[model samples]
Target: MAPALSDILRITSSLLVLMLLMFCMGAINLEAQVGNLAPDEVEALLEVATQLGKRGWNRNMKLCNNTKLPLKPDADNEVVCNCSFPGGTCHVVAIYLKRQDLNGSLPKAIEKLPHLKHLDLWANYLSGNIPPEWANTTLELLSIGVNRLTGKIPGYLGRITTLRSLNIQNNMFSGTVPPELGGLVNLENLTLSANYLTGELPQALTNLNGLKELRLSSNNFTGRIPDFIQRWKQLDTLEIQSGGFTGPIPSSISVLTSLTDLKISNLLGDGSDFPNLESIAGIKYLYLTWNMFTGPIPDWINERDARYGIDLSYNNFTSEAKYRETLNLFKSTWGGNYSKPVEFLIVCSE
Candidate 1:
């Protein structure tokens, strides 16, 4: 009787082990499928396609199949998926539909793509303001530049704390920048250039200590260039040419040791000394044109590999013997004005 009982127990144990192995294999197979696309995501995608005026998306095939919906260069409609969810559920992680000329509104259904991190709609003719429903998303990068997006940028955008890059340039967005944008502490690139935006920059912008590039040119803004820019210790590029800002370029700029390209011009303020850019050895391109900077030419401009990298045109720099000597031939063309109303424009870097 004891031998019979032992045999039955061993048999039962073996069956249990076999069952466990089969379950694991099933799990592995599901994982290998890159997580089956979730039903809600598919529905949301359908809505997205409808809103974007794209008629070619086939609902029958797996959306996660990269061969069918690629995320490569120049691909008109791209959807990237992340399949790391529990139970092998896949979710859309990114969407890029650039240069499509899709005459559609910003899709409110985009909020349903919950896991989406990046959304780019560049070079499109999309109309209307950003949908408020988008504030609920956790997007990291949002690029809608070179589009026909119109209306004031919504204040609700600040609620998206996960954002790292917010580009809305080359649009028809008017009105002052909402102070709420200052809430994006993780922001690295903020491009509001080439818009009809006006009003003073909010003091709240000082909170973006991690900002690297800020371009706010060709706008209708009216205010002093804020001094709080020194707070951005990681800054590399800053462009505000014809940005409608007044006052001297803040001397505190010297504290930004990481500056590489600094372009600021058209200040509506009194004459000031040259901004101290000596500490920034990695400086590549410097453009400070159409201002009233009255002083002797600083060596920092000449210190780089800049045979033609600095554009100090229409300023009031008294003298730089070396620069004058290099451009001595061009001087004869300018009739030796010496640029008390200094005029300069350097060719773009090679």
Candidate 2:
């Protein structure tokens, strides 16, 4: 009682069709579970994936497995995206590509990530000028330090109102700092050291009243140190070295009550000329090396807080021994009547 050959083929075909229909239904259910990400955002992310290399983002993996979203799954530990929101919509909030040994130009399409808050590409081989389109975004932190980037800093960067910290140090940027930078009213830290930047520091920089730290050393900037620096009342550290700044240190510097560390060296001025440091009581570390400052060391320097330390090395000071005496005198205050031996460093060399 074996089944006929034609009947067997018909039964087999029906079973196969049923299995196919079940598979399709399961796929549809899976798709429904994965939440929706904006179409434009998906396209922008794909562009990044293509530019950075497809290996960094895998299409086969679940992007938002935890939340079941349509976001691209993390791949090769290179890219990261955030998709947790009220409406199941995802946003690429941060991109950290630091020290990835990445080489090539930064894609201008990066500006397309509207929700991007932090972008770090430090210690890479990235080159070329910063994209002006970046100014149109809402980035909060942009760090591209220790790279091979060149060309003048784009003025459009000033238009980015959301920026809080901008680090572009150790690059090949040339020309004067863009005056437009003053527009970053909320900037906290601005590092532009170790570059070929030149010309007078734009007076507009005084507008950054909220600035905390400013490092502009190892550049070719010339002209007198701007007196407007006193306006940066919140500054804790001010480092300006190896530049061709001339003229006397401004007396207004004493007005910076919040200053803790002041390093200004290798400038064009008489060795005797120094800033008025009497009012800056918070200063703990003062470095003024390799300057032409000659003349008697100010007695007020020793009168500073007992914890204050200074490096006046390789200067044309009147006498090293006298400077040592000043520091030792302050150290004595710590010991009181016992007058215990104390170590004070007053670096002075021929």
Candidate 3:
């Protein structure tokens, strides 16, 4: 086989070229499979990690792994980023740092987590305004309630169309209700209770037709209850207590046939005849106390199927007989057993 040196050289040259081509193709495939995280996203998360006291987060720790990270004890617990690996790249899906006693402003860098769906920083000591950068997030549940946060509710939050539940209650946020919130067409549960927020309920809120539970209690909101509230046919639980509303209960509320729990106490107003509630069969809890209502109690209230209870105290109803009749109606309807107590506190001296 030791025939021609030129033939052997040609064959070797062809084999080398083929090997080089194969190596290049393999390198491209590997690059596509194990690509690194986006540089901007990494930078944003690193800023958040640094601002939030680092906790269990470290620059050297793997951001995503096939095995879930173990949750450490309170003092040692990290940011708890739940990540998913798709196409060999790690993507954070949720960040749960609830009750961590975290003390700092929310990092604007949070917008970097494009795949983040749930961000629960509940019961933290985080203060300052919510970062307007959050408007760009595709978050489904944004619960930052029970914090020390202050400043006006950001109007930009309304741009988050994918948001389902937004709980910013128990804070110090103040100012008018942002009309921009009406843009959250997918919102179901909105809790802004126990805050220092003032101003009338925005008319733009009518756009949230899909809302289920709305709590605006313990604020300083003034003005009449909006008539458009009837549009929320899906609403089940509604609480607007301790506001400065100075008008009659809207007759349109009767359209809330799905309503089960309702509280509108300590406002300034007379009651409507509430003609719409006459046929509502699912009502469970009805509270209308500490108001200035000065008419005969509506007879239809006795017709309610309040299996839980009813509270109608501290109002200025004119007749004591009307109160007795109301109590008698409840006793008769519930078979006199009174498994659930009904409150009918009449201020006799007033």
Task: Estimate candidate 2's alpha-carbon lDDT, on a 0 to 1 scale.
Answer: 0.73
Please write out the lDDT profile of model 3 over residues 158-261, one tens digit for every residue. Answer: 99999999999999999988999999999999999989988888888999999999998888888887889999999998888886676687888888989978
Clashes by residue pair, model 3: none
Q: Write the per-residue lDDT of candidate 2 for residues 8-97, one digit (tens) a residue.
A: 999999999999999999987655544465567667766765654433544444443323222242321334455556565656666766
Error of 2 at 13 (Å): 47
Q: Model 1, residue 232: what's the lDDT?
A: 93
Candidate 2 lDDT score at position 103: 72
lDDT (10s digit) by residue, model 1, range 12-118: 99999999999999998756657678899899988887887766776797665423232565755677887767877788888888888888888999999988888
Model 1, total clashes: 5
All candidates' lDDT scores?
A: 0.80, 0.73, 0.72
Runs of candidate 2 with Cα error greater than 4 angstroms are 1-39, 49-55, 61-84, 303-308, 319-350
**Per-candidate clashes, comma-separated:** 5, 6, 0
What value does the lDDT take at residue 38 in candidate 3?
A: 52
Which segments of model 1 are wrong by more than 4 Å?
1-31, 65-76, 324-350
Model 3 residue 210 CA deviation in Å: 0.7
Give the Å shift of residue 12 in candidate 3: 52
Error of 2 at 272 (Å): 3.8
